[model samples]
Target: MDKTLHYLFDPLCGWCYGAAPAVSGLLESGGVSLELLPTGLFSGEGARPLDDAFAAYAWSNDQRIERLTGQRFSEKYRDRILGDRRQLFDSGPATVALTAVSLTEPARELEALEAIQHARYVDGNDVISLATLADLLRALGLDDAAAKLSHPDAELLGANQARMSRAQALMREFGARGVPTLIVGSGAKRQLLDHAAAYSNPRALISQLEAA
Candidate 1:
């Protein structure tokens, strides 16, 4: 059956970035109504500086993700994005930018998310910066989102917080621990599809979801 799929993720999550192809496949199938849930996992208190230790850890994981999903974590990205200690590993700004996209150009939220991920992991752009995010969205013809992101007001900020809270509540309900959680269906018939399949074989989820 075609069901509603709730995808729980964070803007700064590498695995979620790796799942892009799978996400695209799911969309192409035209079999489900996919709802994105931003968890804000790397925002506020979860945010941190890009220190050497964390950089190494992230790089190691990035390599694995690259091998598994073929999503590049370029040397430029490693040097300019992860290698810079001054950069904050916060998803807050990017989340707000996406919130702007969700509000304005609702159809292209995935496009925006993929662009943000590519900027960080492949193109070596600083996605956590408001100015950078604003520019990126504008480039995608999302001028309204870009304008809103340029100066995030209280309403935008509140919406971002509310989105994260709702995602977190869903995670709690499913007893899920992290990002890339896919919960299919709704109400009493909800089911958690194996997230591993998204990384292993992007198209596998279509069959899995069909079976669900």
Candidate 2:
């Protein structure tokens, strides 16, 4: 039987970005059917401006993530994303873009997600912008998804909400508190994997997933 893993994450979340490498490792190990669930934690009403207080807090949290996970949270990201006040720190557009990817090419959704995360944390690009996301998707050879994201239709928007609602429902069911929650197994026999291992030790995280 294929081991099912539910990755509950928010695209704009720093910890979720920190957990990417470990999640990728888990996926690459094979024999696992993984689902990428965007929880919409930092979207809609959860979205906020890039104010000074939040920026400092974000950088501090980001540095901790970098120290623990070895994920690069670049200076450009600090300066451009958190430093620049014009951009709103929102994940709705990026989540919608991922939904578009899911609609067009389901298998490549993870790839699209990684690209979006990299754009924000490494490349320091405006991930909230539809144009930017479209360009990034096109760069990944996902022109169809890019086009959908560039001009999102009703179906895409509805699917985006549905996907997030499902993820959030799973979280509530499992009593999961935050982003990057990993729920393994299937049906009535689900197991919530440890979140600490994702940042502290990815190898251990993968082993946990395999065992689950």
Candidate 3:
């Protein structure tokens, strides 16, 4: 039987940013089909202000993630993204952007997610804004996705809603509580890979997926 991997993550998640390398490794390895699922953990009703306490906590956690995964968390992001209180730390726009890519350019969905993450976490861009997300999609040559943003239809909304629901249901099934979760295999034989290995060791993660 063919093997597949379902990656559940939120774009605003720091750990998800850390797990990017390993996810990339899996995509490049060509041993298993990879599906990117956005959980919408930080979107819609879950959105909240990036208050000082949350900002500090997020930074501290981000530092640990950087140490573990060698991903960069820059001062620019800390100052511009975490420090700015004018905007809410909502993942709705980014999630919609990824869904747009998935609908229009399925093959490039992963790339679009990586670029959106990079725009927020690395370049300190406001990815939560539709305009900013459209620009990011365009920069990635995803003009179809960019166009969809200007005039999203029921199909796009339904797809995004269904993806979020599926991701949430999967999390419940696995008793998982956070982003960057991985489910390998499929149907009754599927298994949840250890989330820790996604950042601590990419090769080990690949091996685990292969074994599953």
lDDT of 3 by residue, 1-212 (tens): 36788999999999999999998887677767878899999999999999999899999999999999999998889999999988798999899889999999998998898888888888999998999999989988999999998678898889999999999999999999998999987556889999798888789988887778
Model 3: how far residue 144 lies from native, Å:
0.6
- Clash pairs of candidate 1? none
Q: Predicted candidate 2: what Cα RMSD to the true structure?
A: 1.1
Candidate 1 lDDT, 83-114, residue by residue in tens: 89889999989889999998997888988999
RMSD of each: 1.2, 1.1, 1.2
Estimate the TM-score of every prediction: 0.96, 0.97, 0.96
Clashes of 3: 0
Clashes of each: 0, 0, 0
Tell me the whole-model lDDT of each prediction, alpha carbons only.
Answer: 0.89, 0.91, 0.90
Which ten contiguous residues of candidate 1 have the minimum total lDDT?
Answer: 26-35
**lDDT score, candidate 3:** 0.90
